[model samples]
Target: MKKLILVLVLVMGVFFSGNAQKVPTSEEIAKKNIEEMDKRLKLTPTQRSVIYNYAFDMAKEQLLLYKKQVAGTAKEEDETRIYRLQNEMNKNIKLVLKPDQIDEFNKLNEERLSGIDPGKKKKKKKKGEEEEKVVGIEGLKSTGNN
Candidate 1:
């Protein structure tokens, strides 16, 4: 029947659309970031592993705090949580990096933040607009031009 066919199409569309919009886990994001940093900083495998573990733990903690902040938490509470997270992150960096590397990391973070276009707000794109894959070291190598 026509009604049955219509319902089937609608259900299929919904299923496929949901599958297309999958968000990466915090661990995935942290690993991707660490991998990129390894490439950029020329970090050794041991350094990369340590940094990745630290970042992953930090991201997990921060993500929970962020969720709380989004759900009607006070600004002061959010700020305190973020400050604590920063301290923890700093401590982790100290454990894994030399003082000079820590300084370099701070500067790199500042530069990256500054380079973002302030006027352009990020918005969810329409389904058809292909998502830009986050480029890691392999991606750069594949492109053959940095």
Candidate 2:
């Protein structure tokens, strides 16, 4: 009957939509970002390898803390874990980089955080359309002109 066909279609749509929304793991995100940085910075092979390992470890620790927080762990416990991981990551980074390379690495990370990229062109908004901006606690606002 048509009812059965309609039900099957609806079920299939729901299943596919859910599959499409799968989020990447933190490790996957870190690896992707590290690869992007390597391409942008033109890092040497040795530096790339070292940076990849560093990013992986840092991301893994962060992901663990995030999982705990999401699982309703106490805020204090999450903060403590994050603080300890940050200290360890900082110490490891210092050990991995040479004096000169450390400066370059820091600069690269800063640029990445700032979203500065020569290869990416900023899109211009149409008249009467403004860039969407996020306000602290207030959520997102649509500007009339961007």
Candidate 3:
């Protein structure tokens, strides 16, 4: 019993410690996002600076909106905010990036907005038969008698 208790405590400590690590700050998030874009786009120094500021501002705004639970409470407003941010970022990007870079950036944004990763391929299902669709909670209710 003593050995079991000791092992359980140690296991719990490791689990909690992993979850207790500090969250990255907005600056950290912005730096990482900018670094990724710079790598893919080969950004000029001027473009890098502009994108860094835009990324930093966006990270801070997203953090604030998340903290406010705006997504849960106001779905339309949250979406509108995100769309505006995207537009502003794109406007800034167009001014600094080359024409070819703009096309690449647009493609990257399209992939992100669509939630599709180009590197991973999902297998296609058979086309011969359609799957059954459940209607409402009726399908989930317990049918067994007490």
Candidate 4:
């Protein structure tokens, strides 16, 4: 969910930019995340709790990392750590959610991450478990050998 992180960053950026009278607390952030996820995923009570815990933990880490960055003390490792937190959360979420739910989640998730700059070329990034798409243009697969 790059879109998830991008939305988070944009929201936080806006809040920190003087629009918000006071910074939101960790619990507030977690509650917002849970509400948004609940609306999108239609999570059951159990799924909601599990996701709430996971999202809360990630939010905490993100908040701490953000504070460090604002203080001009965060390292590159901190950035990587946030990425890991997001990836880890997604993995755990998949373990709890049904396959259909995962698909729906992914589809809705993409809607938020769309609209990249028109001038830039697209780059594909795959995680460990994701497979690369194969297009047959009279390639070996076209011969039908499993």
Predicted structure with the largest TM-score when compared to the true one: 4
Measured against the true structure, the TM-scores of the candidates, in listed sequence, are 0.53, 0.53, 0.60, 0.70
Enumerate residue pairs that collide in model 4: none
Candidate ranking under TM-score, highest first, comes to: 4, 3, 2, 1
Which order, best to worst by lDDT? 4, 3, 1, 2
Best model per lDDT: 4
Query: Whole-model lDDT, candidate 2?
Result: 0.57
- The lowest-lDDT stretch of 10 consecutive residues in candidate 2 is 1-10
Choose 1 or 2, whichever is better by lDDT.
Answer: 1
By TM-score, is 1 or 4 better? 4
Backbone clashes in model 1, listed as residue pairs: none
Candidate 2 displacement at residue 68 in angstroms: 1.8
Q: Put down candidate 3 lDDT per residue, 9-71, tens digits, no spaces.
A: 333344344655654467986897788788778999988999999988877765565445523
Candidate 1 per-residue lDDT over residues 32-139, each given as its tens digit? 768666655667678888888877876665556444544666366555655566567656766787666777676655544433322346667798997566477656
Better of 3 and 4 by lDDT: 4
Instruction: Return the TM-score for candidate 2, rounded to 2 decimals.
Output: 0.53
Model 2: runs farther than 4 Å from truth? Answer: 1-20, 98-100, 111-146
Question: RMSD for each model, in Å, please?
Answer: 16.2, 13.6, 15.0, 12.9
lDDT tens string, model 2, 1-146? Answer: 22322332333334345655664465775677577766655667887788777767766665565556447774765656556665565567657667776676567655533435535566788999967676654342222222
